[model samples]
Target chain A: MQFKLDRRVHYSKRMLIATPVIAIALAVLVSSVLLVLLQKPVLLTFHSFFIAPFENFYSITEIFLKFGPLLLIAQALAVGFRAKVWNIGAEGQMIIGAITASAVPVYLVDSTSALLLPAMLILGALGGMGWAAIAAYLKTRFNANEILVTLMLSSIALQILYYLLLGPWKDPMGFNFPQTVMFQDEALFPALFEGVRLNTSIFIPIIFTIGIWLFMEKHFGGFKLVVGGLAPNAATYAGFSSKKAVWSSLLLAGFAAGIAGMSEIAGPIGQLQRSVTSGYGYSAIIVAYLGALNPIGIIFAAFFLAVLQIGGDVALVSADLPISAVHVFQGLLLIFYLATYTFVNYRLRIIRPLTHSNTKPTP
Target chain B: MSTIEFFLAGTLSAATIFLLAALGELVAEKSGVLNLGVEGMMAVSAAVGFVVTFESGSHLLGFAVAGAAGVLVSLVFAVISISFLANQVASGLAVGIFGLGLSALIGRDYESRTIAATEGIAIPFLSELPLLGPILFQQNIVVYLTFALALCIGLTFKYTRLGLAIRSTGENPHAAQALGFPVFLIRYCAVAFGGLLAGFAGAYASTIYTPLWADGMIAGRGWIAVALVVFGTWKTGRIAFGAILFGMVSLGELIAQSMGARIPSQLLSSLPYIVTIVVLAMISTNTARMRLHAPFSLGETFDGVGPR
Candidate 1:
């Protein structure tokens, strides 16, 4: 028995080390077959994917630009996931935030104040929270499935974006286009450097990282949420309200998603549109898990995901890969990451079937 | 306004897709695993069905191809989670993501492609009835098939030996194993069955309802189907009712828009999600309120080997 235990532990350790490497090699091999079908050179296609993202500074910056929103949303999701509160519809919450925060500059575009941008951003966060709270409230009050509520809300948010773009928020000066009016000088997020899309949005992520780390490390609320997830019955016995934890985790996610939404519009697009709420809200779930649901780890994971997005775009333009190929790569990464963990905490064994006459016979 | 007529048409339309997807999820949930790839499977199948039907002009061929594609993707999920012992939640999510990606890639050429759909297969005498006519008889074959499937499923649960084994595998795998039932085999079959149903649902949405393929045509309906299982609280009868309610809400916005109602159409469009949240809250809060339903061992991953 002792010998078997040691062998099993050693086997697991080896599997853990080789798992990601093996999965990536397999994924790359599969992608090569796909490329061959596309009548593209597999060697060049492979190079353009793994190495080209880091080949130039220009591409690197673009990667960070894409990583910004993913970082924010993934961090938000990690909070709720750790607490076991599934907020699957960050896309809807994101759109709500973008629409809400854009309200300041859309109607009050001319208001030049030091506080206008900050105030609008805060409103954006509130919008995301408000959207998430609907799910949280329903779940807490009625035991509604948060997953469905969130997913359904995302579609509704898409419709709402279309309505806004077509109706009051439509750009009057433009031709027949589905987009909101561009923000004025005051509303646009300040760029930190010229010729670069990078801006104050990076600070939001930095602050969130520190805040989440400290909250998880030091705060009572954070401890309760994590503990609630690890042992729900113990939490209840210890007088912790599972409902309170649910609200906090959900509300925090909303806030983070909301801010990310606002950042998307204010920093990059500088306007509200149907495309404002992309699949980042949903993809962040993968990002959260890939980061191992840890605050510090998520930062690296978010950045890595951002690189994949950038690499995808680069491969699309230079290597002649379609947008779908990048998405496929992302999917491959998710599958590999998820599959690798099988070797983490589990040990496998086989034994002969039990012999019992008391049990009912199978037909 | 003939609200009853409108509601009936809307509900049946919704039921065609929801019933198919929800039934598949029901089987998966019953097998002690939650595979959240229903939405992704639907999306992949939707695109595949659209492309096939567009080329062959045969709805049957398209439906079959879609189902095969869905099963193929779900097998990957089953292999990772069931065989590898990967976290079911994460593996399912990965499968869903992969499905979406695969569908998008394979169906890229079929974007904006339109095809002939599965039209209503009307029953003779039933179609003549006033209220129940359009409600039941005048719908496509899939809608009628759903009712039959529901009945057969319920009967299988109560009377069939195979059903009993499936149930035992879910409730207690160790007990099932000692009794000579292969728990893993039962779960594998259940999940694959779910994939087949989900594929049909996706194909139905693409071929019959929309008759066109888009990147995100399934949207989040698969997720909605997952919640339906919880709301039905695990009873096939109640789930059918719950699926109809969801279907109605889903079609409500379109019905309102078609009728040219004065409501801010966007807010009305969101009613499905709002109702989903409300219904879910109601069902999940009180065990009794769940209508004495819910699978005995839903979403619990069985390792197939445990202490007796």
Candidate 2:
């Protein structure tokens, strides 16, 4: 028997909603096999990966801390992804943003101005936009592939961060460590609770969620962006500028990633250091895809990923599993998600072998 | 050998890594398949190659196993992007992430470990020559093999039916299918071939060039190899030449340090990537040239039974 993929006349909405759940289940199952291969306790590992992060208040706060950046970056990336403008260099943009925002705190070590934080945020956004704008210009003017360009820029950005930390930005009074001075209180976001790292910075992502939802679901501009991605020819026929879509989507993503970067330095990190990004840019891509590129779905997806990230840390101590296991899980999750997503639009059918009786003569 | 001669010789060894992978990518792209997981594939192979060579004390066996591992991993990408009809970019990224994670997992314990470097095999008379001998003839076995592979691939594209079939399939899958070519099979072979060479390059890097196991050692070389195809405009000879040019830039980092140049090492290390961006922008600006050389069907999904 031969297998065939038959396009569904009308896809079931249930499958569309259920796909992420199925993908998660499949990822867990596959990861269990990997755990068994490594001679680790599958049950305990699963506990840490899914349950341990929620057992206590501190871990819960940690989840939210991670959740903020993932939410912000994923929402921004989803917009561009919907418009089919690939910007995988959010990490680089975030780094640049962090650098630009830190300029305010680094240079103004004694400032008590209330506007300093706002200025930093704006500068961070501009930094990210300026970085992403380079790719936009190259893509529009030279037709260069954004994927390669952005990725290369990410590598370059890392070097720049290292150069600064090692050379100029090194904290002078605090030994020769490769990091800048901690920000003053005025440059920092206020903590939501006593002794907790979770801060008011979380409001940024919450606000962005609602904003993106309204924009994509209600605004005509968002409709045009979606159309441009889904059908470029139709979008062009209707006279929506694809170039503008590319520029806006990339710049917006850069803007969001930049804010996420600034929040990182201003909230929990409180200083410019080497581990600034922690792969948030890459993880946000998975969140974007897992959420089906939807605003509301991204909320849940980002939260889930944040929990898993916290859990992955717990497992490092409790289960003795390598940190790479989290990356492996993420990879499996995305692969399974992409595989199962195919069923949303098409159904598989088995074709019976053609017998002589059923066979038609050549015309 | 003088500094210039030494630089040329070092450049070839450096270029070998990118050349092998780029040549493979050239073939895969020629068949209208864009597998963006080369970095991941090389990472996995590099880890596996280092471990195997260290354990078994045979570089050949390590390379063989690495190539097999690459094929196995790349088949995951092949099945997902091709058979499952997933977005090629997303699928490739997932595969890349998975490979990197897997490689790190495999090499976690093997970090800081060293392996014996593969020694250069000298040609009898050619080794006696002064200038050209050290620069070209006297090198490790993998270097000579890569050069031979590049030549063979270039010649095959010009003279062979299989080459025509692969190129035509890349140019237009529907027309190729109508003309009785097995598009899927050819693409599968092309991707697998690309995987094998990437594996070889990775193994060469770990077992011969660096002779050590380190997490993330493959770095951005795989991506540079991908860019090299565009820089060379998808031609075999030009891609090989581009790889050597990058090799010189990469070697310049070491040379500058040795010379005690005042420039920051980070800037020098970043030169290859910067050059890749600049070269890509320059090459891609010529739309007519890109249109002439690029596979028309590259990155587009081909469905035989879809309602077109």
Candidate 3:
């Protein structure tokens, strides 16, 4: 007996929505087995892993705080991914944005103008776009693989961040620690609610989601990009320049990732530090996929992923599970989702081996 | 040993890790599959190898288990990317992320643990030779095996039918399949073989090179291995050279820092990754050359029913 996969002519909308749900269920089941193997109680671990994050108002706000960056980055990445122009180095771009945005507070420490915040956000977006432009230029001119170039560039960005923090950017008055001085009141983001760490930046992703939905669903440029990805020959025949698609996709992703980076320092951190990276860039990739690369889907996906992160932390203290187990769960979610995504386009069927007649032997 | 000798020895040991992994990736790519999870595979294997060696007190067992662990993880990759026809790049990334998390979880207890370091065996009579003896004749068994493996791969590609089949499959899977070759099976084996080598590389890092278990000890060597394949233009000899070059670049930082160079340590630390990007760009810019050497179906999914 053999199993065969038959390609479906059209993917059903129902499966499109159901696949992620199924993948999550499967991932939870697998994690339960893993928890058992580790000698942790499955029920208690599950409660901490999935349920504990929403147990309080503060933790709920924390989830939104995490969601802000992830959603922004994922939405940005989805644009590029849809165009088949992968910009995996959003992490690097985000870092550059953080640096650029922080330059305002670091250089103009005494300035308290209200315009400073908007200027920093713009500068942050520009910084990210500038970093992504390197990959864009290499990809367009030199035909370098964006995947490798972007990934390598991310490491370089991290190193640069380390260099600045440990050297030039180190706060002189802070006892030689490798971090920058806290931003002034004007540099920091205003909190969205009293006594909550969540800031106005949360609205950034919410607004971008609507903007992305319009851009992807209604804009001609987006249609061209989708054409380029789905069928390059068709795109070329229609006179849509692949170069423009690549540039637009990367720049947009860079811009969004930059905003995310700026929001981190401006919102929760209020200071530039090495820990600002915190895997937001990488996690955004999983979020982008989990959201099915749609604006609305990305909002939910980002929220789900953020909850996982917060829940993972809570579980670390309450369940005695290693913090790394959270990372493992994230990884498993992606793998499982990718595996189940196949079902959206293909159905499995069992096949029996055909028997051959022995007429020649009888003769 | 003089600084030069020390650098050379360090370069050999460092290069061996990349050489092993890259050679395996080269084979997998030749058979028309790309496993970007090399970093993750190495990380997991490093952790697993460290724990096994620490508990069993046998480096051989550690190395063996590490290779098996790599294969096991890669099998997950194969099942998803190959069987399910998922995007190869994303699948590889998932595997890598999974490996990292799995390694971190497994190595939680083993953090900061040290093991008996594997020592290089001195070749009889050759140890008496000045300068060259310490650099070449005295090295760990894996270092010698790397050289042998490179030679064997080169010869196999040039002279063997299996190599021809793999090259043919990578070039045109449809043609290979129509000609009765089992494309999926070949790719599966190729990917599995890559995993085994990656595992060995990881084990070597934890048990021999550093002789210590630490989270992320493999660092970015796995990614370097992936880049080396492209940098070498998929050639065994060039891959070996690229590995040695990267190994030297990585060690150069330590040498510079130890010698009290005033450059920021972070800049020095990033040299290898920077060089990897630069080298990748340089090699990839020559499209004609890349087309000539890169497997045509390198990352394309074969669903067993298509002409493509």
Candidate 4:
């Protein structure tokens, strides 16, 4: 007997929808086994992952709170990822965005101007773009690998954040912790609910979702980016600039990440601290791939990951699992998703041995 | 010892970690495979190496086990990217994240634990000479091994049939396959070897250099090693030079901090990453030179059929 992979004549739409489901199932199964190995309550841990996030109103809002940044960052990353322009350093861009946005409130401390938030948003985006632009410039001008440069920039950005937090921007009245002064009410986004942390900032990612969906699905510029990713030579032959694709992809990703970063400071965080993004930039990469780089698909993926994030936090107390376990689970989901995605392009075929009589030239 | 001698010795020790990992990555890239999971692999090795050494009280045993763990972790990357034909970058990132999480899990209980640093081996006559003798001849066993490995790699690439085969596979796998080379086997072996060295680098960090188990201890060293390969333009000798240069810069940062320099330690700590971005840009600026040195099939999957 022999096995072979034959290319499918048509794209498998069924598998496209089912792939994430299967991947999630496999990840859950594997996590259950791992939990058992760790002597944790497997079922309860999973309850926290799958059921706990939806158990109450606050937790539900918590999911959306997490969803906002994940959605915003993933949508932008998916676009750049599609263009084959890797920008793994969104974390750094996000940090820069947070810093730039916080600069407004940090300097003014008592501002009641309604324009502060708006200014912070734009400055936040520009900061992220500026950070990302460094990588784009290096990539286009010198052919430096953006993956490495962006990652390096992330490390540097973190240091810069630390420098500012520990040095000049350290809260004057606070206990000398390495963080900025809290933003005034005018600088903060209006809360969506009376008690919950969810804020009007959630609208930003939703608006971005609609905008990116239209641009990717219904625009010629998006077509050019796709072409640039799928076939660089073809894109070049068609008069599309590959350099433009690189610049635009990185800049857009930076822009979205910047806004996400700004929203975090202006919304739930209300201050620039050490753990601002909480590895959202990296986790959003997983979200982007889970959605298969589709703008609409990312909305669901972001929500699902948001649940996992909240659930993981819950499990920290309920299951006595460490925070790293969530990272492990996310990694497994991506690995399984990538593995199963192959079936969409190819199908397995099995061959059986022919009978001896049938092999005798069929009489 | 004089301060300069102490600094030089530290530089050499620091260089070994990057040297070992970058050498492994260099070989893997030569065979047209890019395993970006070096950071995660090193983390796993560091954690495992520390735990093994802590438990058994044998650094050698720790290094061996850590090296094995690195190979096993990298095989995850090999199967996903090579066999499943997934995107190499994404697969590598997945493997990297997994390794990091796994390492954290493995090292959770061992945090803050310490082990005895590996003792330096001194050549009989060479140890007593002068500044040069103490700086160069006296070092840990792993350091000597790394130096030897680098020399062996340089010689192999210049003189061996295996080297030619790997290079040809990187340049054009189809042509190499048509010439009857087993491309898959070569790539798998190359990636595995890269994992082994990465593991060694990690083990050295946990077991010898720092002799401590700490979360994220490997830090960005793995990424720096990856950049070192590019900074060297994929050449073994130049890579060694770049590693030493990085080692010196890192040591210089430590020295500056200790000297009560007014610069913030955070800023000093960030210097290496900044330098890496700059050097990467500088080295990559010459497109012709880069094209000539870089493996044509680097980060690309082999379809296992005729050329696409």
DockQ each: 0.57, 0.84, 0.80, 0.83
Model 4 residue A194 lDDT? 89
Per-model B-chain TM-score: 0.93, 0.98, 0.98, 0.98
Per-model C-alpha RMSD: 5.1, 2.2, 2.4, 1.4
Give one digit per residue, the lDDT tens place, for model 2 in A17-71: 9999999999999999999999999999999989999999888999999999999
- In terms of lDDT, the poorest run of 10 residues in model 1 chain A is A1-10
Better of 1 and 3 by DockQ: 3
TM-score of model 1's chain A: 0.88
Q: How far is candidate 4 from the true structure (C-alpha RMSD, Å)?
A: 1.4
Which docking category, incorrect, acceptable, medium or high, applies to candidate 1? medium
Poorly placed runs, candidate 2 (over 4 Å): A354-363
Model 2 chain B lowest lDDT segment of ten: B299-308
True contacts kept of each: 0.66, 0.72, 0.80, 0.77
**lDDT tens per residue, model 3, B12-85:** 99999999999989999999999999999999999999999999999999999999999999899999999999
Model 2 over residues B136-227: C-alpha lDDT tens digits?
A: 88789899999999999999988999999999999999999999999889988999999999999999999998999899999889999999
Q: List the residue pairs that clash in candidate 4.
A: none
